[model samples]
Target chain A: MNKDRPDRTPESEERRAVLGKMASATFAGLMLSGVLAHAQDAAPQKTLIPARPFKVSSDANQDVLIRMQGELERAMQKPINERRWGMVIDMRKCIGCHSCTVGCVMENKLPPGVVYRPVIDEEKGTYPNVTRTFLPRPCMHCEDPPCTPACPVGATYKRADGIVVVDYDVCIGCRYCLTACPYQARTFDFGEHWTDNAAKGADGALALTAARAYQNPPNFEYGKHWERGEGIIPKSPVGNARKCTFCTHRLDQGMLPMCVSTCVGRATFFGDLNDPKSLVSELAGAPNASVLKPEAGTHPNVYYLN
Target chain B: MTRNTKILWALWIILALMGGIGIFERLTMGERLAAYTSYVPWGMWVAAYIYFIGLSAGAFLLSSLVYVFGVHKLERIAKLALFVAAITLVMSLLTIWFDLGHMERNYEVFTRPQFHSMMAWMVWLYSAYFALLLGELYYALRRDVKNLSPREIQEDDRKLKRLATIGIPLAIAFHGGVGALFGTVSSRPFWHSSIYPIMFLVGALLSGGALMTFIVSVIWPEKDEAWLDLLQFLGKIVLGFLLFDLLLEWAEYSIPLWYGVGPEADLVKFVLFGPFWYVHWIVHILFGVAIPVYLLTWKRDARSIGIASALVAVTFFAIRLNLVIPGLVTPELRGLEHAYVDPIGNRLSYHYIPSFFEWQVLMGVVALGLALFYFGQRYLPLMQTLNNREVSK
Candidate 1:
C-alpha cells in the first residue's frame, strides 16, 4: 500500500502540473482578448474631448447625467450629419415638478402662449385604484415632419442632425404648421409681453421697467441673437412659428439642452443616437421605449420609457 | 337716388368707418387683440375668407353657363355675375391678407413657394384664377367699351367664350384647391377627407346661385315677365344645388357618426351638438335650407324666392364657420390644452370667439364688397339690358 501511494502521488503531481499550465495559458488568452476588445471599443472615444472627464463612480452605476454629458461632448467632435441628436424620457423618474418646462421657457425666453415643453399630467383608474402619471412633452423633431411641408414659404425645415428649425425671418405666420403638427408642439408668438399690463412704478422704480429689462435680454436660438422688438411692425419671432429646437444654440456650445440639465430626477436623456455608446441610445433601445402618436408615422427622435 | 340706394350708401359708410377702426387696431396691435390662439390658429377671418372665395367661385361658374355653355337665358346677367365674382374675389384676398401675421411677407408665397405645401398651391392657383378672371371680364365687356362693327363684336364674343372656357377649370381648380388646403392637413382628422373639395364646390354653386337670384329679383331694372322667368330659373338652379349641398353635408356628417365612435365621430358630434349647435340647426338648416326648400318647391313666386335666396346667401357664412372652427376646437393631443396655461396672453386656451375687432374687420370687407358692387352697377355697363343692346345694334 505504501509503494502504490508513492507511485500515485508522482502521477497526481504530474497531472496537477499539466492542469496548471493549461489554466495559465487560458487566463493569458482571456486577458489578451479583453484588452484587444477594450482597445477596439475605445478607439473612437480616444479622439473625443469629454466636456467633463468620467471618473470611476463609487456607486454601482454611474450618474446618467455625467454619462450623457460625456456622450454629448464626444458627439460634438463628429460631423453634424453623422451625429443624430435624440432624447429619451424616463417616465418613471419624472416627479411632475415641471422644472424642465420652466427651464425651457427661461432658456428660450418664451412669451405667453408660446411653450416649448409642457408636462401633461393624467389620472388613471377610479377612486382607490387611481394612479397619476406625468409626461414631459417636447418637440419630437420628427424625421418625416408634417409641419415642415405645411409651411407655404419653406420657412420651417428639418436639419441633417434630425432637428426641425423654423427660419423666423422667412415665416409668414400663417400658422399652417401649428395645425399640421400632430403633437401640437409648435406655437405662434403673438407679440405678447409680461409687462404689457404691468403697472408703471412711480417713474422708474419697479414693475414695467424691470420686467422689460428682464424680457429684453436676447435669446440665442439657432445660434443667432434675437432681440424681441415692439411696435406696429412686430419682429421676426413675434409673428413666427416657434417650437423647441432641442436647444441647438446650447448644443452648438457643446452643452446639453436646458431641459436635460434642468431635469431634477434625471428623467431626460439627450445624446447622439449615431454613437451606440450614448445613454439615450441605450435607453431608447429598451422594450418599453415608445413614441407619442406612433400611428402618425412622424418617426420622432423623442422616445418615452413607460 | 331712391330711398333703398340712399339707405345702402348710409349703411356702407357706417360699416366702412367701423372697419377703419378695426384695421387701425389690427395694424397697431398685431395679433395681440385677436382672439385666435395657437391652439385655434384660425378664426373668423379664415371663415370669412372661405365664404367670400366660395361666393366668387360660384358667381364665376354661373357666368360660365352664359359664356362657355352658351345659355342665352343666363347671358343677360353674365356681366353682372362676372362683376360680382371679381369684387368678391377682391374681398376674399383682402380679408386673408389682413389675417396674415406678417401682411408684408404674404408675397413670399409667390416668391419662394414650397410646391409640397397646399397653402402655396392655393395661392398660386388663386393668383392664376385672378388674372384669368380679369381677362375674361375685359373680353365680356370689350364690345361695351365702344361702338364696334359686327365682325369686331363677333370677335369679342369669341374671345369671351375662350376666356370663360379656360375659366371654368381655373375656377374649379382654385376653389377646389382651397378645399384641398384644409383637406390635405392629415393632422386635422375632421378636414382630412377626399370629399371636402367636392363639398366646397357644391356649396359655392348653391350660395353663389342664391345670391345672384336675390340680386336679380331685387335690383334688376325691368320687372317684366322676362325678369321673373330669369329669377325662376335661378331659383330652380339654387334649389337643385341646395339639395345637392345638403346631401354632401349629410354624407360628411353621417359617415363619421355612423359608428358613433372614434375621433372623427367625436368631432362630428361637436359640430352637430356642441355649444354652437344653433349655427347648424337654426341658421344653416332652418333659415338656409328648410325655408328656401319650402319656398322654391311650393310658393315659387319672385317674392318668396327672393327671401329664400337671400336667406341662403347670408346663412352660408355659418356653413363656412362650421367647416373651419370645429376642425381646430379639439386638441390634437388629449389633455394638451390643460398642459400649459397662458397667464398673461390667455392665447393658449382652445376656446375662441372672434373678438369685436375681428367682426369689425369683416364688416369692413363686407362694406368694401358692397361699395365696389354698387359703383360697378352704377357706372359700368354691367346692367345694360338685352333690349338696350338689341336697340343699340
Candidate 2:
C-alpha cells in the first residue's frame, strides 16, 4: 500500500529491481565459495615435480641441487678411486623435516629397523630461552671404517670410490660389523613386512594390496635388483647387515642420493672431496665444520657445518 | 626307572616342547620373534654361548690336574670332567649357531676366514680345542673298548695323559680368547677392558670346577672315603677360583666407579642401578656368590658343597647376561633411541629383554646337553675304569 505512490513511477520500480538482483547475487556468491573451499580440502596438497633429464641451469645463483648434479656428473668422469665421495650437512639451516628419511626408505625399500638417515632432535638452554636443534645423521662412510675389518668372512669391504659395500653372498650375517660401528649406523634386517598383523577383512585386504605393491619390483640397490624375501638362507638385506651406501647406484646413473635431493631446507651437500672447488670440499674446509666422535679415529667422510 | 630318572625325563620333554616352539619360530620368522633389534643386536643367546663355553673350558682345565699334573685324588674324576666338557662345548656351539642370522653360513668362518677378526681366531682356536677333546676322550675310551689288547690299553692311558698336557694351554687360549672377543670392541666401553680376558679365564675355572664338583657328588655311586676326598679337593679349587673371580669383578667395577665419571663409570652405574639391577644384585651376588660362598665356607658337608657348586653353575648365567646386555644398552649417540622407532618389530629399540622365545631356545639347548650327558654316561665307561688287565688275568 505504501509503495502504491511510487508503483507507477519508473525510478522506484528500477530501485526495487536493483535490490532484488543484489540479494540473489550475494546468496549465489556465498554458496559458490563454500563449494570451492570443500574442493580444495579434498585435493592432495603436495606439489609434484616430474623427473627430467639432467641439465645445467644457466640462471644466476642456480639451485644447489642443479649445481651439485652437474658436479656429480663431472666427478663420475674421473677414475673410480679418484672420486673420494663426501657429504657436508649444514646444521643451522635444518628445520627437522624427515623427508630425507622417507625418501631413503622409498628409494631403498628399507624394511622396519633398517634406516639409512635419521634426524636427531636436541633442545638447548633453559625453559624460558629454549631453542631446538636438528641434526640429520647419514652414515659417515669413514675413511677407516671399523665395521669392514670386523667382518669375519671379509664380506664387507671399502670400495675403491670410498663407499663401504657389503657383499651379501659372502656376509655370514654374524653382525660383528653392526657391533663394530662407532656411530651405531648399521642395522640388522629382521625380515619384517609393513602390512603385518592387519585384519583379514575387506578394508585390510585393500590396504595390504596397496602396501605389497610398494615393496615389489625390488629396489635397485648396489646396482642390483634385490628381491628381499624371507627364506632359510634369506635374500640379501633380509639377513645381511645393511647401511647407507650414499645411493651409489643412483650416483652411477647421474643422480644425487635420495636424501640430498629430498631435504626441504637444502641443508645437505655431497660431492667429491678430492676436488677442492666442489661445494662439499669448500664447506668441509670451513672453520665450523666438524665430525662426530673425532677421537674414535674413524676419520669420517661426512662433515657438519654449524 | 628310578623316581629321579622319571622326573628328569619329564623335565626334558617339557623343555623339548618349549624349545621346539622357539626353534620353529626362529626358522619360520627369522629374527621376528626375537626382542633384540638392530640397536641391541646381540641378546640372551650370546650370553648363554659364552657361559656354556666357559663351563667347558673350566671343566677341561680341572681334568688336566688329574691327567697332566698327576693329582692322585682327582684322577678318578678326570674322565668325568672330560665328558662334561664335551657335552657343554656342544651346548655352547648350538646356542651360537642358532643365534646366527644365517645359521647355514657359519661354515664361511672356516672357508673364507678373516684372520684379522678376533671372532675368526676364536673359532679357529676352539675348533682345535674340540679336536683335542675328541682325541683325549677316544684315547681314554680305547682302554675300555673290548676290541683293544692289553698292550694297546696301557698305551691308551699314556697317550691320554700326554694329550691332557697339551690341552692345558689350549683351554686357556680359547677361553681367554672368548673374553678378548668382547674386550677388543673399543666402541663398547663396558666390554673394552684389559681385565676382561683374565676375568673370563677365572670365571671359566670357577663355573666349570663347581659343575664338576656338583656332578661328582651326585653321581659318583660309591660315596666312600675316596669320593669325600675328591669332593673336598674340588670344592677347595672352586672356592679359590670364586674368590679370584670376585677380586677381578671388584677391579672391573670399583676402579671405573671410583671416579663417578667417564664412559665406563656411566655404564657401570647403569649396571649397578639400571632396569635389570636384580640380574647383578640378586641372581649373581646373593644367590651365586653369597649363599654359595657361605655353603662352601661354613657348611663343609659333601651335600652342602655340591649344592653350593650347583648354585654357582646356574647363577653364573646371570653374570654372562650382565656382561653382554650392559655393553649394548647405553646408546652410542644421544637421542638415537628416539630418533626412529619400529612398532611392529622390536629391534629398532635400544631397550631389550629376552622374549619368551629366546628363553625357550635356551631351555632346549640345556635339555639337549642333559640328554647328551645321560647318553654318554650310559654308553661310555666314564665312571668305572676298564677291567684292569693284570687284575682280570
Candidate 3:
C-alpha cells in the first residue's frame, strides 16, 4: 500500500517507469516505419508538365484581377507543412453497403455494440420523388470537439496530429461525455464478444483484423498485438466509451483507413488537407462539399460532397 | 426490543425483496439491461443521482440553521434530516455509477482530472460536501459527548458529533456545486441557464423540508403543537422556494420560447407539452408544488399541511426526472429520423425504460438509505430534549 517508498529501492520505480516509456516508444516507432514506407510507395508521382489554367473570380477588373493574380502566385509557391488528416465523402457514389462500418469494426477490434463508423440511409420525399442518400459517418475528428471538455478524467482527447483518441486505461466508464456529445459518435464497451462464427464475414484479411479479442489487450490504438490464429480474442478495457481514432495505427503504418479502402462504391477519400496536391483537397474545394451540422460549432473535419 | 426488532426485521425483509429482483435481472438478462446508444445516451439513473444530491443539500442546509445559527425549534429534526441527507447523497452517486458503461474505469475521474469536466467538479464538490457534512455532524455531538461523563464517549454519539462538525459546510458546497454543474453547461439551453444551481439549491431545500416533515409523521404519528408550529414554518420556506424555482424556470424558458428559436425552444416545449409534458405539469407543478403549498397555506390546517408535505416527499423523485431527462433526450439534430431513437434501436416500444434490475438496485439503494437513516437516528440522540427521559429501557 505504500506507493511512496524509501522503504522500497529506487531502482524498482525507475525500472517500471523506463519499461512503460520503452513500451510506448516501441509502438510509436513501429507506426512511423509502417507509415513512412507506405507513403513512399503509395504517394502518386506527378510530372509538373506546365499548363496554364484560369480560375474565374467575381468582380474581375484591372486592380482586382491583378491583386487576385498575385494572391494565386503566392498560394502556389507556399511550402507544405505537416499533413492534416482529413476525409471527403462523395454523396453521389454511396451505395449503403455498410462496408465502412464493417471495415471500421474489423480494424479497430470493436465490441458488438461499439461501432466507429455507420452509414446513415436517407430516403427523400414521398413515393414519386423517393431518393435515398447514404451518409457514411466516421468520427468527424472535430477541429473543435465537444467530447474533450465533457470527459471528467480527460480520458478522451484530440491528439496534436488531429486524431481524437481515448485513454482506455484512464477512462472511468462514467459515460458523461457520451451524453454530452452532439453527434452521437461515441460507443460504450459493454464487455461483449463474438460467440460462435457469427462475426466471420466474407473478407479473409478483414476477419483477422476484426477478430474478437476476448481478453483484449488495452488497444487505445489498433494493431494485431494478439498473435495470429490464437483463436482467443482478448478483451479491451470493456467498460469504457470508444470511438474511431481516424485510423491512427493504420496511418502510422502507411495505409488508408480500412473503411476508405474497402468502400465498395469508392465513396470515401482520405488524405492531408494541408497538402495542396492531395486529392481530398481538390474534392473538398468542389462546389458541393459541405460538413455535417455546421451549426454544432464543433467544426467537424469530415466533408461530404452532395 | 420487541417493537424495534420487529421494525428492523421488516426493513431487512424489504431490502432483501428489492435486492432479489435486482439479482434476478442481472443473472437472467445481463446483456440486455435495457440498451442505450450514442444518440439517446442518458436516462433515469442520472436524474436520480441529482435528486438525492438535492435532498442531501436541502437537509444539510436545514441542519446548518440549527448548528450554525442555533434555531431552537428547528434543532429537533436538524440531525435527523442531516442523517437522511448524507445517506441519500451516497445512494444518488451509487445509482449513477452503476448505470455507467465503464464503472470499472471510474477512478480516472480522480487520476486524470479533466479540470474542465463539469461532472468532475461535481464529484469533487460532492465528496468535499460529504466530508463537511460529516464534520458538522461531529461538532453538533460535542455537547452529547460532554454529557457522557468521560467514559470515552459512546461510540455512536462520538461518531455523529465528530463527523457533523466537519461535514456541515462541505455538504453545502457539494450540493451547491451540483447546481453549478448544470448551470455551467453552456450548451443544452435547459441546463445551461445560469440560475440552474440556484434552482437546484432551492429545490433541495424545499424537498428537504418536505422529506423531514413526512418522516416525522410516518415514524411518529402523533403530532404535538410544538412539531406542528415548526412544520408550518418549514412549509412557508418550502412553498417560497417552489415559487422562486418556477419563476426562474419560466423566465429561462421564455427567452428561447419568445424568440421561437426552433430547436432551442423545442426543449422547453418537450417539458411543457411534448412527450414528458405531463411530468412538468402534473408532478412538478401540481402535486410537487401546488397541492403541498395549497394545503399548507390555502387550507391553513396543520394535519392537511403535514399530509401535503408527505405528498411532496413522495413525488419529489418524479420532479427530479423532469429536470435531468428531457433536456438530454432532445436530439442535437432536428431531423435525422430516429436520430433520437432509444439506444437499443426502438426494439422496446418505450424509448427508455429503467429495467427490472435497474429498478431493483435502485429500490434496494433507497431502502438501504432509509434504513441507514433510521438506525442512525435510533442510536444517536438526534431528537430534542424532552424531560431528559432515558431512551433505552
User: Highest lDDT among the candidates is held by which one?
Assistant: 1
In terms of DockQ, the best-performing candidate is 1
Candidate 2: lDDT of A155?
Answer: 88
* Model 1: CA > 4 A from native: A1-61, A200-205, A230-232, B1-6, B386-393
Residue pairs clashing, model 2: B37-B347
Model with the higher lDDT, candidate 1 or 3? 1
The candidate, 2 or 3, that scores higher on lDDT is 2
How does candidate 1 score on lDDT? 0.88
The digit string of per-residue lDDT tens for model 2 on B108-184 reads 98999788888998999899999999999888765666667767777876898888888998899999999999898
Each prediction's whole-model lDDT (CA): 0.88, 0.86, 0.66
Model 3 backbone overlap count: 48
Show the lowest summed lDDT stretch of 10 residues, model 1 chain A.
A53-62
Q: What TM-score against the true chain A does chain A of each candidate get?
A: 0.79, 0.80, 0.64
Q: What is the lDDT of residue A225 in candidate 2?
A: 81
